[model samples]
Target: MAHQSTHETVDARRIEVIAPNFKRRLSGVTTTIVQLVPAQRADGLEIAALGPGLPRHLPKLRYRDLWRLRRPPQARAQRVWHARRNTEMVGGLVLRDVLRMPLKLVFTSASQRHHQPFSRWLISRMDYVVSTSRKTAGYLERPSTVILHGIDLARFRPPGEKFAAKRAVGLDPNRKIVGCFGRVRRQKGTDLFVSALVEPLRANPDWIAIVAGRTTEKHTGYAAELRARIEGEGLSDRILFVGEHTDIERWYQALDLFIAPQRWEGFGLTPLEAMASGVPVIATNVGAFPELIIEGKTGIVLPDLEPSTMQEAASRLMKDDGMRAAMSSAALAHVAAHFSVAREVAELRAVYDAVSPPAETRAGNAP
Candidate 1:
């Protein structure tokens, strides 16, 4: 896709919303901004993203575009500056308070842990705050609207046949495949997932597991250790580690079961993504997994990080074909009803409307 030039004739007056992601790395915050920007625009809101690492196709405001905030965007009393990170929040505060720009600062808190003094101060300055889950909201000192992360349902729906999806991904169609996807690290509990599946995978000849994701430089030793353990058990063929894939949705579609064994997380979305792809998840009780997973309905949630705990849950779910099928249907329905991207966009728009100027003055001044 061709990128919009920095000098392109984008009407600054039309930009009612500015979503800033200063971080270069593609974290969950970056992912949220990338998904929501287009959806917000589709809802007739003139939203644009600002910062590095975002896709070229999305509407963006260049660094030089900061000047535009001095004059309120057309059809809005003040442009909403949406920040997802502490640095982004600082940037927004600088624009609004330091530069005296006519901007409304909005920060979305995703971390479930207690904030430091610096973070608390930054968050307190926001005109409005959004929390990704109820658990996340508990950490906030101020009032925050809980808005759970939603997935692009159209992009992550079920494949016609699970085996066909496996074949397309170059896997044996006959064997039942389970997957553990995300950053391969100790914190993500990649080791926990592997350890738990070992006994069950060794026992069941028809079943195999795949670990799909990248292990960064810091976690190279940890990834090698996990691989070494798998090799030592002579289960290399049964357990495979395929590196990150650009088209992760297709991989999710191929899985008979998905595991998210994170030791900790801040509103992790892997379980939601798995459910959206019509796969039942077996996730650890971290982040918002307890709330996202409907226990026996959508998938099983482990109370602790024990390999035995996960093994028992996985074995039961895997053996019961009828129950797995029921969970699959329930998973899809649950995501569609509660976690659609459209719903997230609507909820966020309502928050923006609440902080923005009235319709009369906003519309009356628009050229």
Candidate 2:
């Protein structure tokens, strides 16, 4: 009964935009929706999220509310259904074709690889498509507007004092900190980061490294093995696996350097997040890392997944305080100019405007 009331309330709210997240787990796509929905709303777009596992603070559409898409809401423009995942794309097709919802389906593709036939068919049905990067756009059979992801600058700004930030997070304030954050698994290059930092961290007593983020149930053994390696090297104190953090921006603020050693990625955002927090990064040339990092300015970009490559880059950055400081400044400036959430939202608004129905059509269908 309570759920039914909530559905009616959401239905009557006249959501002009619907961002769907069919996946329950908080993935990169889910994170994007959570961050961008509010920013879109702040820009005077009546955007609401639909699906499970989203936070309650954001406006949400219940399953029943999908029915409203069939008839234009009284005071609203035509609805834009933004989909990121394959499942959401499929659902949007059913609503738009089978039920004949007055929805403009827009899909944002982040994957850089070739798609299967099933996925390609879904892509063919989108009214418009957006790619998160140029590389992502290359994978699409149809032309797509390239719009890179952006970080919320306000939430990810640098702390006034790095040492104080470290101390606030129960880390050693005196040590120079480097961080590798994300899921702890082989594909994410957790072992690569651990191996690269082990020797460098051991040699430099003043330096400490952090491996933040959790290992899934399947990857528990991998995490344990990495821990054992750190313990065996007698660098457990210096190389810490502090696990997953809720306040990840604080961790980025506390770092002098950040490393993204992923072997492969669809589109990694940690490098941008680290840069936004005024820290330089060392990232492998995978996904959009090469495009995001300004080599010799914001951070170094390595060509391979070799641990020695990351080690060399990290060693160089660590040894030169002046270079690190310059890179940190450049990193912050680069992000502010090119990667803020405001920029992403504005670009997305343009896409929505281009694809959404005309005011007259919307008004004509109004209840």
Candidate 3:
């Protein structure tokens, strides 16, 4: 019932997880809801091919279920058949087999891109299509649904003391902290964050920054380049690299501000989490940032994602305690109202009921 549920539960409703990375925040929260559907009931499988060795807490669906359900096969025939078969299977199992059962199909991000053909095919058949961002939802012409991923306020709640996080993370608590957490990749705009944000904040001795997450992939070299830039700018002492850590919320609490200078994002879950933790967020105005943030109210959004503009916004937030406090309070209130798990789940369930065939009272003969 709690959207922040960590344990596994099952039921009769057929809920599928089409997200590729089950361990990621969106997939994790989506799966948490799927778990509550009741037992012996085969809901939809969340097909995230994010490789093996997932977290133990994540439930395991049959391999066939995952492989069969994943969007748009490279082969044309296979993709069509897959969607059709999925539709028929869900329709039969939920509508014909169990009269009162419900069926819900959800997918996110790049998965929508990969499976567009299959997605369009399944759209008319699906009870609900959940898009993580309105931009993503716009890609779908059909009547669809949206649930920007919800953060677990229970875990990501504001820390009792902000300084404790800085101390715990080996940062100087005396310095004003501006931090970014999440995978360091081109799409995430790590380069932009450093150039746009970190460089501008360099003028203030009180401002320090930490970029945390694995920088060892193809992006490792890029990370190296960023480090080199920091050194070149004489900011070695100011910027710290805190690689990947399991306890990320601790990192959230450590910061005076949270910065996400991404080029584009899909309903960025982190900002919501940061807001829930009562940290003021300064993010690029791309994807769902406009939807999640209330400009100067909940958080500040960069009008132009350029480095100069970004740096200016970051500098403004860093310098103004009154504005930061107002934004922080507003951020928490915004999350509680719009991004709360209960609100999202309730909306999703309504979609499920509306789309469920038996639940549909539209008379076939009605004019």
* Clashes per candidate (backbone, < 3 Å): 0, 0, 10
Can you write out model 3's per-residue Cα lDDT over 1-367, one digit (the tens) per residue? Answer: 6466432422211223222232333333344334332211223222222223344444444334533333322211111111112333344334323543222434333223434566466555554456666676777756555667566677788878878877887888788788888788877888777887555565677888888877656677878888899889888877778888878888888888898888876456778878988999988887688888888897888887688888788878888999999999999888987876656556654443354322123444257
Pitting candidate 1 against candidate 3, the one with the higher TM-score is 1
- Cα TM-score of candidate 1: 0.95
Which candidate leads in lDDT?
A: 1
lDDT of each: 0.90, 0.88, 0.62
The Cα error of candidate 3 at residue 329, in Å, is: 1.0
**Per-prediction TM-score, please?**
0.95, 0.94, 0.73
Give the CA lDDT, 0 to 100, for residue 31 in model 1.
86
What is the Å distance of residue 71 in model 1 from its true position?
0.5
Ranking by TM-score: 1, 2, 3
Error of 3 at 120 (Å): 3.1
TM-score of 3: 0.73
Q: Can you tell me which runs of candidate 2 are displaced by over 4 Å?
A: 1-13, 74-77, 357-367
Question: After superposition on all CA atoms, what RMSD does each candidate show versus the true structure?
Answer: 2.5, 3.1, 8.4
